[model samples]
Target chain A: MSPLQTTWHHIRRSPFQSLIATTAMFLSFFFISTFIIINSGLSTVLKYFETKPEITLFLKDGLDTATVENLQKDLSSYQGIKEITFISKEKALTIYKEQNKNNPLLTEMVTASILPASFEITVSEPEVLEKIYQNYSTKTNVIDEIIYQKDIITSLLNWTNATRQVGFAIILIIASISFLTMITIIGMKITNRKDEIKISRLLGASSFYVKKPFLLEGIIYGLFGSIFGFLFSFLLALIFQKSINSFFQPITFIDLNVNFYLILLFAEIITGTLLGFIASWIGAKRYIKF
Target chain B: MKIVFDQVDKKFGIVYALKDISFEIDQGEFVFLIGNSGAGKSTLLKLILNQLKPTSGKILLGDIDLSNGNKDDVNNTRRKIGVVFQDYQLISDKTIEENIALILDIVNYPKEKIQSRIDKVIKEVNLGTRRFLFPSQLAGGELQRASLARALAIEPEVILADEPTGNLDPENSWNLVKLLKDINKENNTTIIMTTHNNEIVESMGKRVIKINDGEIVKDYNISKKS
Candidate 1:
């Protein structure tokens, strides 16, 4: 019989054993793929917040043009400031009107004289916002009130880090469990086929030849497990895509296309195959003897 | 292929399984290794199979040193010989035909000729009709024949029957021995049969090497009938 036929025969003879092994592998890869999607979503949300304007400095009225230009240059020279956009009072009024365009009363009430000119500053890192706030908060002559969302950004970063750490720990535990499950199942198979192995060895079969079917069995379990796991994960992600997108409103955090999912599926297959190979190698090494 | 055991000694934790054993069987010779249980007959066969390394001496098969050869050498030596066990050792889940095919597959026999070879050996052992039956469905004698067919499928230079008839009835034992004798004469294959049945040994009138307590006590050949 061919190696594939032998592997299939072994699987057919003990279907319950094969099911248990494949199910264990499926659960592991499912969690792993889910974690990857969630982690990617979290990173997207973090990036959205990090790139937004964190600090907006309202300028004092009647400030000279040269002073404003010098202030712009000074802020530009700051180490971590990524961008500094000077919004005139007219531009601010225009922004307000555009934002409230649906309400005629609100649009009519806003004017250039009433709106404050501002400097919107974005930093490369969230921690840089604190330093800029501390250094520029004391400048009351050129700055009216400094507004920044330091607390919200800091909290978001902390939560993302915590979730990632916890998720990684869980994945590690699940991966280890999957590996052990494969080892135990394959080892049990070897034990059950002790007589067959002995007889084969006595018939002049090489060690590799005797173990070929078992190694192929392991690969089969891993390959099918990973494929099914990826399918389930993809289905779940599709089911929750709308909810996730609305939750992170305007960020499009979970806008994954079919190509991306296909890549993930490929990656999962490689991982599962590698895991199966190593586990089966260890199993065969521990049990198979001449 | 001839097998040579040169002053071989096998010790298991200071207890001698086989001690100072020296013997040589020429090519195509049929010899009976007669011994009781624990007389080191299995150990001697293991030495020939390269399953057990001699503690103090060398074993050579056709110039390949089994005692000190590499893994490939040992495997090559084993591939040149076939083994039959007392319990028939057929895989329970496979049919008799599959059991024979498995050996051919393991030896990397020509894929195109595998079916023909299986048919030839199965027919030789008179198991052609029962080729599709599993081991559990076959009677004791049939199982032994299936095992013998599996051994013959390899077309080995040597056939080692370790108590092949130990579980058979007297009539079945005689039949199996006759089959072995016919195979020996036809194929000129070396046959080493281990047995305690003195009646079969006396009636066969073939070469006999008797072992008692890990030592060779008797070596003789009876003249054949005209």
Candidate 2:
């Protein structure tokens, strides 16, 4: 029989052993894919929030248009201002009404006079948003209340950074476990077929020929393992898409694109193949000598 | 292929297995390596097969220095040499035909010619009727013939048998030796076999190399087979 057929024969003969190794690979891959899903979703939300206006200052209702223009000019002179725009009473009222149109109770009494005009500022650096707000809100007579999103942006960014680290850490731990487990499982496989390997060597088979079946078996383990893992995570995402969406702001939901799936599949297969190859090589090294 | 050993020394840990051992077997010669247990008979076979390298000397297979050969070169050398083991070492799961086919395929023999080649070896070893049987279903004598068929299928220049008749009865052992002698004479193939069977050693009367305590104390030619 051909070497590939021999590989199949070995895998076919040992169902439970193959299952255990593949399952080890499957579980690890599934965990990594799940991490990727949550991480991507959170990253998308954080990116959305990151682009919104960083700081908003509500001026006193009686402030004249010229006073608002002067507040804008003062904000412009600050070091990190990207853009500063003064929202007039009419625009602020229109926006407030638009935001509360479904809640007539909240909007029925609101009018231009009641709604304070504000300065909407976009900063080049997020850190400067707090600095600009602290300096202008406390000292200016024109400012009635400050509605800066500094805290929200800071915490969101922190959460993003922290989750990214956590995802990386988890992947690291999972990869280590997969590598060790692969070595062990492949080692056992080598031991099981030790006699065949010796016979092959005695027949003047090349070293690669002797090791090929087990290596292919390793690759098969990794390949099927990762494929199953990817499917598991995808199914979980589909089942819990709404629940996952609830964790983010109501404005945006997770978009599962074909491109993302394709990329994930490509990445996972490469990882599985590499792990299988390396682990199989190491394991076969010990027993192929016979 | 002619086999030559020049001042070979093999040590496992601190103990020597074969020390200052040197010998030569001309092409197509049938030689028996006879020694008691721990007499370095197996070590001598391992050295000839290049499975274990000599610590301080050289083994040459037809002018190819095996001690300095690379891994790939070693495989190339082994391809020209066939080895048979005491336990018959046939793959238990495979049929007798498949066991021979395994080696033929490994050496990348021509696809259309593999069947013919296997048939020829089976006929030579008188295993044609048992080709479809697995090793476990065969008797001790049949298994040895199947193993011989596998070794001959490769059409190797040298056949190294490590106690080929170790488990056989006198009739079976004599049959196995006669087969080796015929193959050696007909194909002009070099045969180096290690054995402790004094009856066959004295009766067959071919060339004999006797070893004791990691050294060859006797190398002689007896009267031809009667």
Candidate 3:
């Protein structure tokens, strides 16, 4: 019989041991896949926020349309400007009226002259926003106040960065636990088969011949456990689909996309296989030296 | 292949399993190692098998020195030798056919001829029609015969039987001895067996090496024909 067939027979002879090993792998893979998906989703949202304009440029009062156009033209030529959107006084008043529609008294007193016209500018890179303000905020007469969300943007980036670091650390820990668990389980199996191994070696079997089956057994455990974990997470996502979709804005709905599911499954299985194989290598090395 | 042991000593912590042992057996010779329990019979066999390194001596199989041999050299030496144990040592989960096939497989026998080899060896040991049976289904004699078949399947130059009949009836013991003798004569395979049974040792005596308390006391040819 092949090494694969023998490994399966060994597993079958001890059902409880096999179950515990499979479950250990299952939990680890499941947690890893979840972390990867959530991390991917949050990364998408943060990336969008980082590239969108957080700075609003209010135009000087009584500024002609030509001056506003020139200011818009000049901002586009800047090094980091990604987009420039112009809001005229009349249009600004319309937006103000729409925003205060629920408050009739507040809307009745608002006029075009009272509302300010502005140019909303976004940068290709968020960190260059300070440079943009220093270069043009006071240098241009057409510019009034160069308002920006330094506190909001910086804090958001920091939170996302911490989440990413913590998420990776947790995934790494799960993988380590999975690796250690595979070693312990395979070690127990080696002990159980100690006599068989001795006899095999005495019968002229090489060390590779004796250890191949255990290595294959570890890989099989990882493959099945990862697939199980992936499917389990899929079912969980399906059951909580509505709540997760509603948790963030519509832009983040892409987190639950079909493509992401498949990609996450592939990544998890590959990572699990590597972890299992290396763990088995370590276990086999320790015992098969005899 | 010839086996030579020169002043071999095997020690375990403060105890010596074998002390100042020296012996030689040529190809195709049948030698018996006779001693009481704990007389270092098994330890001597393990040294020949290269399972245990001697504390302060050298053993050579043909031109390959086993004392300081590399891992590959030890493995190659084992490939040229076959072993049968007292406990039968057959994997209980595997059928008789699988038990023998594994040895042939490890020896890198041609995959296409494995089944035929298994059939031939099983038949040689008089274990006909029992190849598909598990070890638990066989009697003590049958199990030992299966173990013998596994050893034979390797087609090794030397067959080391620690105690071929240690766990068998008188009838099975005689039958097994007869089988070993026939194979030795027909295939020119060296047979090194360790046993304490006086009747089995005296009946077909070829060369006898007696040990007591880890020392060789007698090395003589008591057989009348030799």
Query: Residue A87, candidate 2: how far off, in angstroms?
Result: 4.8
Q: Which one wins by DockQ: 1 or 3?
A: 1
A best-first ranking of the candidates according to their TM-score comes to 1, 2, 3
Assess every candidate by TM-score: 0.88, 0.85, 0.83
What docking tier does model 2 reach? medium
After superposition, the stretches of candidate 1 with alpha carbons farther than 4 Å from their true spots are A58-82, A87-118, A123-146
Clash totals in order: 0, 0, 0
Cα lDDT of model 3 by residue, B1-226, tens digit: 9999999888999898999999999999999999999999999988989989999988999999999998788888898888888888899878999998888888898999999999899889989878899999999999989988988997889999988898898999999999999989999999999997888788786899999999999998877433
Q: What is candidate 3's CA lDDT for residue A280?
A: 86
Stretch of 10 with least lDDT, candidate 3 chain A: A247-256
Give the clashing pairs for model 1: none
Q: Pick the candidate with the highest lDDT.
A: 1
lDDT (Cα atoms) of all candidates against the true structure = 0.89, 0.85, 0.84
Give the per-residue lDDT digits (tens) of candidate 1, residues A1-290. 89899889989888998898899889889998898898888888888877767999999999999999999998888788888999999999888877667579988767798888989998887677887788789999889989896776789999989999998999899889988989888889989889999888888888998898889888988888899988898899999999988777667778677787989999999989888878888888888975
lDDT tens digits by residue: candidate 1, B1-226: 8889899999999899888898899988999999889999988988898878899998989989887898888887888898888888899999999999999998899999999999999889888789999999999999999989998998889999999989999998999999999989999999999998988888888999999889888889977654
> What is the DockQ of the complex in model 3?
0.59
Clashing pairs in 2: none
